[model samples]
Target: MRIEIPAKKRLVHETRVPIRWGDMDAYRHVNNTIYFRFMEQARIEWISLLQQSTHTEDAGMLMVNGFCNFYQQLSYPGELIVKTYVGAIGRTSMDVYNAMFLTSAPEVKVAEGGATMVWVDLITDVATPWPEAILAGLR
Candidate 1:
């Protein structure tokens, strides 16, 4: 099955992640789990930037859910361009997505995934509305 990302999702971050040899299985294609990891790396990178923009260590994002859809097989010895998108911003939560493609074939997406993330006050351990800086950063 295929899942479609938001047509109007904002592109928030982009990074390259090299495919490690050990990321593959006996079939020589990348394992399913690694795709989630790739998406995770993007999310963490973006969230870190968001936190920096907020200039606060007391607030952060929590990924309450995640998922991936693999449309093509990826092999080792290649690099992936991960594009992160964010949208559906709510009172305390937002939707995040990643579309990954081989560096050599940018037009062909190998996998895509997303997570529903919420903002939280780390010290109080409670959900909070997104900080203004974080909201500005998203836009």
Candidate 2:
């Protein structure tokens, strides 16, 4: 099946991660909790890249909400291509989406997930509006 990201979302980042043997559960498949970590790694990597380009100090993002859905089982010793997408840029928050596919089977998504990310002033610990550079980095 052809999976389409919503029109409102923009593909911002992509990375690949290897599935480690320790990531598996007793069922010999990837544990459900590890999927969240996989997504987190991709998101943090993307955010760090964005921060470098934007050069925003004491400014970052927080995952206010997050969720995931598993489509197919994932096993060990495989690389997964994780794609990150952004949607609905609000004043201080936006939606982030992630999709993971095994490198050996790029067309099939093993899992998908998302989080509502809020821009924040780390020093003040308060939500803040998206700066131009952050917006530029995403768009």
Candidate 3:
């Protein structure tokens, strides 16, 4: 199925995560690496919620690839709200999109990103088709 990445109307889930001291960079702002962490948190939350609703586990979803675009800077002692959603559900993988905005400056979008995760067998570490439960939950 073709899914248009929503321009504004839909945000699958929003999560608030605190900026920790460990996240501070040499410039004294939340490190660039930390932004990826925030994205991961958002993605996991989405996956976990979907799993809970479907009575399944997230171990089946593996992070095969991901990326981020930093448009603005965020400093310490701030809260980040991460918005996430399923961008597409393919035969063996799914794309999860995300956007991060500083709660302190709700008007500013700090970053936008997405990732490709493949359904896999943890033991075998091989790609597999999207599980029926996950596909159903996406709908």
Residue 50 in model 1: lDDT: 69
**Model 2 worst lDDT run, 10 consecutive residues:** 1-10
Candidate 1, 35-79: lDDT as tens digits: 999999888888787655432589877888888989899988999
Worst 10-residue lDDT window for candidate 1 reads 47-56
True-vs-predicted CA distance for residue 46, candidate 3, Å: 1.4
Clashing pairs in 1: none
Top TM-score prediction, candidate number: 1
The Cα error of candidate 1 at residue 23, in Å, is 0.9
Q: Candidate 2, overall lDDT?
A: 0.86
Estimate the TM-score of every prediction: 0.85, 0.83, 0.83
**Candidate 3 per-residue lDDT over residues 42-103, each given as its tens digit:** 87787788764312243466788777888887777789888887766778887788888889
Off by over 4 Å in 1: 51-59, 122-126
Candidate 3 regions off by >4 Å? 1-10, 52-59
Q: For residues 53-101, what per-residue lDDT tens digits would candidate 2 score against the true structure? A: 3225798777798788889999898999999988888999998889999
Better of 1 and 3 by TM-score: 1
